[model samples]
Target chain A: MKTILESIALTKIFKTGKIEVTAVRDVSLKVPEGEFIAIMGPSGCGKSTLLHLLGGLATPTSGRVLVDGEEISSGKDAVRTDIRRRKIGFVFQRFNLLPTLSAQGNLEIAQEIHRNGSRDRQHVDEILNLLGLEKKTHHKPSELSGGEQQRLAIARAVINRPAILLADEPTGNLDTRNSMVVLKMIQELNRALSQTILMITHNPEAAGIANRLIEMRDGRIVSQQQEGEWNAAEDRMSL
Target chain B: MSSQLILSNVVSRPMRSLATALAVGVEVALILLLVGLSTGMIRENSKRMSGVGADIVLQPPNSSLVLAASTGAMSVKIADLVSGIEGVKAVAPVYLQLNTSGGLGLVWGIDQESFNGITQGFVYREGRGFQGPDDVIVDDIYADARELRLGEEITLMNRSFRIAGIVEHGKGSRLFIPLGTMQRLVGTPGQATMMMIKCHDKSDIPGVKAELEGRLKSYPIFDMSSFAAHLEEANRDFGPIKFFTRTVVFIATLIGFFIIFLSMYTAITERTHEIGILKSLGAPQGYISLLFLKEALVLGGLGFVLGLGLTFGGRFFFQLLMPTLQHQLPPEWLLYTGILALFSASLGALYPALRAARQDPIEALAYE
Candidate 1:
């Protein structure tokens, strides 16, 4: 399988006046096409920062990141923007949906940006149905429930069928029931549609649904585990 | 869709948007009034000078034109020298003095026979035109303004004068009297402010003007075709009303600029998180900047239309309410004012738009 994403010793440093803080340090990683991977860590461990670097949302201070074999770490803003638009879809913990737009309008914004005003209604209906948002299509974010709004956001994120989905704590604001629903929907998108996903989360249950898991601590990757081996590792760690 | 977003944003806060637009509207209305009054004054002054139906107007070398008349004293004898010019058919030496009624008033002193023969477009609406030494013809504006009836004596310049006739407006001065009476009253007998000359043929104006200029080399001369230029040049010496119109327009633009700047900046601050989300969605910097510009443009367009309506309607009521004041707003000025309002609002929005566009996606998303 072709590697869809690769980050070689990627490091990100943020400068605040006289102090320099490293958010991601010497992190090397790779994911094949159609793989679903989860990064698990405590808060402030730079998992989100690592996801940001891989998704072209932020540039690394050192090393390189490649998406579909094209180098993006050193690309200029416009090129990085183009990559993000055409290849990556992001979902935030807060949903980040425009409140003024209906679920349909929000989906249309993504659709229009992807093809410059060309839209496939059937494709949109399919995504909405897949996310169980068909009935809530015309509802604004304010009118939708927490789970419905998150689903609408997921629908918006995938409406363009981008190559990769980068979700950062997508269920952080949801209740346990809604969190399970969103996680199940994400797993369905990966398993049924062969979609590639990279999610940052603190939930072990959420991590268990992914095909592979990477654990991070102090801005560095500590271990990588496959789903087949994850159960045994969890058992041994608990012991 | 982007423009639609801007529209939705505007509609979301109707009062703030309207207040901003109304502020701009006030500026537009003020600009319209200022331009209207000043241009009207300039045009009316030129009209009065040209309305004497004169082929040439001769004044002292340095005489300046006030709003409705010439200033800087000169010899009334210029009429004698100018009347001898080759094509000169008639001469009228006009004595102009500013008088006060309720507003700035122009009083013209003319010899009835000569001034009336050369002047056209004047017809009495009631009574007669200038008969007795103390008799005067007042335009409808002044008559209606002072509520003077025919044969009513009104004190002017501390001298009592009877209103013999009330001529229609636009004929000339608000007040007219006999030349000798005014000359004596002003204590400048045999002196005139300017001389009006009529040629036998209107086409012979160039020849008449050349002849006058040759004999009266020290005097400033004017003809019908070059009247605006001449008045403007003469006005240079009198010190134009630099503050009345230009200053008002400058202040109006400044007000419009600051209003839009502060309003848009506040709006951007309020929508910082939205801007960040848009950026994270892969919206280009240009796209983000364009959203703010579109907002301002829509606001400006709204303000411009409102201002135009108010200016026209307000001026109508004002002109109707105050018969003494003349308010004439030309179409070109109306169009210019509309453009200025729009342009000022857009210009004011530029800095805020740039600031919004430059906001980082991460910071904006986290903004409160």
Candidate 2:
């Protein structure tokens, strides 16, 4: 399989009042096309920071991140932003959808920012249907339930058909039923569209749905496991 | 695509800020209109004074006020002496009598041939030239008020003359009659109030003024160009009134500025988060600034239109209420309105545009 994203010795250090804290330390990661991977970590383990770095939202202090075999981080700020817009899509823990726009308008805004003119109601409807959000197209984020708003954010993230969808705590605010629905949709999108998805979550059960799982502790990956093994342990824990 | 979305967002939000901007714009426009009207009046007066056909005015010393007040005089003999001056194309001696209305009315006695050579026949709405030595040409205002018309005989200074025509002059009410007849009626044969001189060379105004002033130092010699300067001097003479009007305009514009600033500041505050959303969505800082500018310009434009209409309408209404408002239209209206629109828009947008442009995308996005 062709590697869609590769990071070599990715490191990030943040300064907070006379101390330099390592958020991600010399972390190297590889994500292939059509792969579903989850990065599971305890609180402050830098899983979200890793995802942000991979998504081009922040620059790594010392490392290289390549998307589709292209080195985007070495160029100017404008070029990095363009790559972020064209190649990567992000889903935040808080949904981050503009409260003023309706669900449909929110999706439209994402498409517009990317300068994708082929977007239409039909495309929006298809994504909404996939996420079971067809009936709530006109609803504002404030009016929608937490689960629905998260689903809408997911729909918006994948609407541009990015090479990779980076979701940070995609279902952190949802109940078990809604979380299962979102997991199934992410799985289906990966299988059907050959889309690579990198999701971050602390829930082992949530991580169990990915094809592979990497566990992190103290800004370093400590373990890697297949989906079957992770699921079996999660089932045992639930029992 | 980003620009279109930003525009839609800005337009969709409706609040008190928009109303305040519109109000500021309206006030700015009204102020512009007022300034335009005043400047227009000055320009119109200048035009009428310098317009072709009326070349010279003869009067007693301090005749600027006298002509404005329509008082004082020069003997008829001076008119005859000036008529013989070289390059004196045509001459008409004028006599004046103050009426009960407190306005000066000219009793101009001209030889039929010399008058036609010098003064262009007044633009008459309803009449013809003097038919005989006893006939007269009255002003439109005086004729309209008194219900007099052409061929109707009227008495001035106890002499009856037929109303030959009703005329329009930019300055004052005037009645034209035959020279011999006017001299007999006013008891001043071969002696006139003042003479109107028409020169052969329009460019030789300085030479004529010098020659005439030197010859008639006892009397006042006013060329047409001097009237414009005299009007400026007159305006300067009423120093307090000029200062007061300027100060009032400045205060009114400053008030407009404050209203615009408050409106824009509130708008920026309310939209800080929205602005962050836009920036995160990839809107450039310049585009964000443009949005605020567009709002200010819209407000200014609407206000200017409203104010211009009000000013112009007020001018005509004043003319209707008092007939002396005819002197209030000119080219300066264009200049003042343009300046006011620019001033109001810039004053209103300066701070708001800077604040909007300097907003940080990260902080704005993180705002709750």
Candidate 3:
């Protein structure tokens, strides 16, 4: 499979006054077309920062990121923003749907930001139906339940038919049932819609559904487990 | 997306939006009233003075060059001196005063014989001219408005006088009594407001005007054409008044500007999280800034509409109460006010839009 996204030797540093903190250090990763991958880590382990760097939402302090082999990691704001608009969709852990807009409004906004002709009403309706948000399309973010909001955010992320979907803790705010529903919807998008997805999660169960799982500790990937490899590792650890 | 975002923000805070619009409306109305009243005065004065039909008009030194009000201070004496000049045909002594009962009305007193001799262009509609010291000739429009007719009695300066005749329109005044009666009535027995001079021939006007100017340096001599030009020049006196009004307009605009600025700034500040979400969705800075700008522009448009309503309503009531003040609500004024409202609103939104554009996507999304 062609590599849809790749990050090489990416490092991010935070400088507050006289103090310097290294958030992400020398991380290299690749995601192939139509692949579903999850990165699991403890708090402050730089999972979110890595996701941002991959999605072109932030310029890495050093190294670079590629989308379809096009370097997009280090550039001006407009360049990165343009690449993000063309190729990336983001779903945050907090379900970052615009509270002022309805479910459909959020999806429409995504298509509009894409600046392409992908904002077909029929396609939007079909996606909403697939996400089971057809009945809740007119509801605001606040009006929807936690699980519904997460699903709407996911629908918005993919509405533009982006090259890749970058989700950081997509189900972190949902309950157990909601988390399962959201994870299943994400898996459906990855398999049925052939969407390339990179998700960050702290839950091993959430990582279980991914085709591949990469575990991180203290800002470094400890090991990568493929399909069934994660389940095997979990079983071995439990024993 | 830009339009939808703007509409949502505006609709979300209906009260704040209305207040900002109303502030703009008030500023526009202030400009309309101030500019309209001054324009009305200039236009009306030119109309009345142009209708006089005299070759030359002479007035007291300090009075308006064309309106010819005497203030009862100029001696009826100027009429005699001007009449004795070469080629002088008629010298009509007239006393003009502002009536206390009505608006800035002129109460004119004329000598019937000499005033009638010149083709003053007044047509009598009913009855005869003034026959007694107590008889007055009233204007046709004033008669119809006040429901007055020939032989009807009306009080002037506490004195009851009969309306001996009704005259046609364009005579510049409603109440017309005998010149001697007006001089005695206003307690200035030998004073006249101004003298309307007619030469024996149209060619003799220049000589007569020159002679009058040379003899009475305290008085100004203006032929009909020059009088119109003089009035046009006098229109410049409104410059300071207009400047003062414009200063007030600027202050009013500032109030509207600040209202929109503060409200939009605070609103954007409160919505920083939403901005972050938009940015994460691949929305650009221009898009976010345009959202706030369009919102401000809409508020300005609303304010302009409200201001126009207020201006027309206020003009109607003001005219109803004071019939003498002419308010010409020019169409261009409305257009100008509308444009200014939009411009000011946009100006107010600029800072906030820039601030919104500069918001960091990560920091904004991370905002709680």
In DockQ terms, which candidate is top? 3
lDDT of 2 at B16: 57
Give interface RMSD for all predictions.
1.3, 3.3, 1.1
Q: What are the per-residue Cα lDDT tens digits for candidate 2 across A1-239?
A: 89999989988899989999999998888898989999998899999889867876667889989988876546244555567668887777778887667888888877876664445768888888878888998887889988888889888888888888988898898888877777777777888888899999977777776888998988888888866766456452221
Against the true structure, what is each candidate's TM-score?
Answer: 0.88, 0.65, 0.81
Docking class of 3: medium
Candidate 1 chain A, run of 10 with poorest lDDT: A230-239
What is the per-residue lDDT of model 3 for residues B116-143, given as tens digits with 9 covering 90 to 100?
7554546889987878999988877677
lDDT of 1 by residue, B255-327 (tens): 9989999899999999999998777777777778888988998888888888887788877887777666656
DockQ, all candidates in order: 0.49, 0.17, 0.59
Better of 1 and 2 by DockQ: 1
Error of 3 at B229 (Å): 7.9
Candidate with better DockQ, 2 vs 3: 3
Alpha carbon deviation, residue A32, candidate 3 (Å) = 1.9
Residue pairs with clashing backbones, model 3: B70-B193
Scoring model 3 with DockQ, what do you get? 0.59
Q: Candidate 1 — which residues are off by over 4 angstroms?
A: A13-22, A115-138, A232-239, B48-56, B65-69, B77-90, B120-122, B131-135, B151-161, B198-239, B242-244
Candidate 3 local lDDT, residue B82: 81
In model 2, the runs with Cα more than 4 Å from the true position are A72-75, A116-122, A125-139, A175-177, A231-239, B1-4, B11-13, B23-27, B43-80, B83-170, B173-272, B275-362
